[model samples]
Target: MSTPPGAAGKGRSLSAVSRDRIEQHLKFLVGVRHPVAAPAALQRACSYLEDTLRALGYAVDLHGFFDGGQEYHNVVATRLGTRRPEKRVLVLAHFDTVAGSPGADDNASGVALLLELATMFKEWRPELTLQFVGVNLEENSDRDGHGTGLRGSRALAAFALQQGWEIEAVVVLESVAFAGGSVRQAAPAGVPLQVPPNGDFLAVIGNELAQGVVARFALAADSFDIALPVVPLVVPDNGELLPDTRRSDHAPFWDAGYPAIMLTDTTNFRNPHYHEPSDTLETLNLAFAVRVCQATAAFLLGMAGGEGAAPS
Candidate 1:
């Protein structure tokens, strides 16, 4: 793998990945943030995300749409590219959860990292317009998730297309915490690909159009301060053959013919607490989550044309 651009010469420090802040964010977000189940918590989550992005010097936009006669929101923060303003890159995480589950690992972890990344890249001059989006309603109201759960992302994709935006990449973070243990990890049933048995690695899964992005992320992970084990999987036909790969918001972008990838911990495959009330802050590994931020910083730095060093 090629060396990640902007990696430190001798040593890399994860100082930019603030563990305390990530934990704080997670603490505030660890609740049943469903519109119907915990509407207050869900509104609070949206406001917090918007306030955080505004504090980071971003012009935040609340993309609202009506679904089932109820208004839903997607928090979007845009940082225009310095060199190539037309090219765009997005980092997003869904902020809503199932009815009963607090969704700490299901998505609070992902939201915390998304906020941290937005803070880390605030001052960077990347070639691609960096967008940090907090999507809502990713978790379907139905238990089987066969309904209109991805409406937020699908609407955003359609809006991007309407504006004729040139999207370079879309990185979706889903259930990124809960790593490092003796418990064995399992691939989705009947999938032939070989994965490490231990639940110690982050899975970077992409569609055929996102092959290069997946490879670049793997290289970026290698150059970070910590040893972040990554399993890079590229699927054909936009992961139609493996339904498990299409579980998150990135699936909608793929449907819009845009390049997107999902960074996850394999969800139910590794996390026994998936969609359970037990998926709380105490169950997450914050250090592992910090490492994910560091790796993502490296990836964005490389995409910035290797012009300047990443935050310390």
Candidate 2:
């Protein structure tokens, strides 16, 4: 496999076989129909995530809760750091795809990245607690915004609050698959984004309160030659007010006042297959996805060190 342009020395390039393996995994996850209310499919996806994490030697748990007369469980896996366990970093992604769509880039890509990172970190211990969460209900029936559209993340945040968990930062990975645009387009509202319009970059967006973390992530992105646009916005009070910004799992973390950022390829805006039946695995840029994963892994490693190094 060819080394991604900006990731020559930081880490080894994923082998062709490894890349193929990730692609196959993405195909399997996206191929499944994981609707929010579909208990069977959700169970299957959750089990798959759990098994993957367990195979990597991480202790996994399921947060099962009742919603809409059905049982939904979110998968949480932890990789205990060798250093300070009190400091925690949460990496989140929703596994529940939209109803009727394959959701290849919408979510399977994100899950694939998470699993790949987990594989990389299996041997190298981190300094802070790293939690990989596969959330549920990112896409649900409540279009009116009354219900917890982000049930899994919201529940996790509430649990953290109750437990008094000291989260250093939270990173939400979503739609890190498709990237083919230029760098001059206007970012979605609520965040000031300056990315190549070509879509071949990662965007880290958070509330104004998380600006420091976002800046650090951006700095770390530079070491890997990953193009990351950091956007720190002033999130509004009414959730319904910021439709574009409030569209993903990261919003819940921001609502809770935690330093959080959404790492994405700008879903729906640049992805032609967003939320459509045609959103298949073929539409994803596998090379770019691998690059994104590598960059993200590096950023997480840097953050665990507490340096919050800016991208060179």
lDDT of 2 at 273: 82
Minimum summed lDDT over a 10-residue window in model 2 is located at 1-10
lDDT values, one for every candidate: 0.85, 0.71
- Across 5-121, the per-residue lDDT of candidate 1 in tens digits comes to 446443666587799989999999998998777889999999999999999999899999766678889999998876788988899999999987999999999999999998877
Candidate 2 vs. truth: CA RMSD?
Answer: 5.4
User: Please, what are the lDDT tens digits per residue for candidate 2 over residues 41-140?
Assistant: 7677788889998998898998876566667778999977657878888888888776678789879889888887777666656678888888877775
Candidate 1 — what's its lDDT? 0.85
Q: Pick the candidate with the highest lDDT.
A: 1
The TM-score leader among the candidates is: 1
Clashes of 2: 14
Models 1 onward score TM values of 0.94, 0.84
What is candidate 1's TM-score against the reference?
A: 0.94
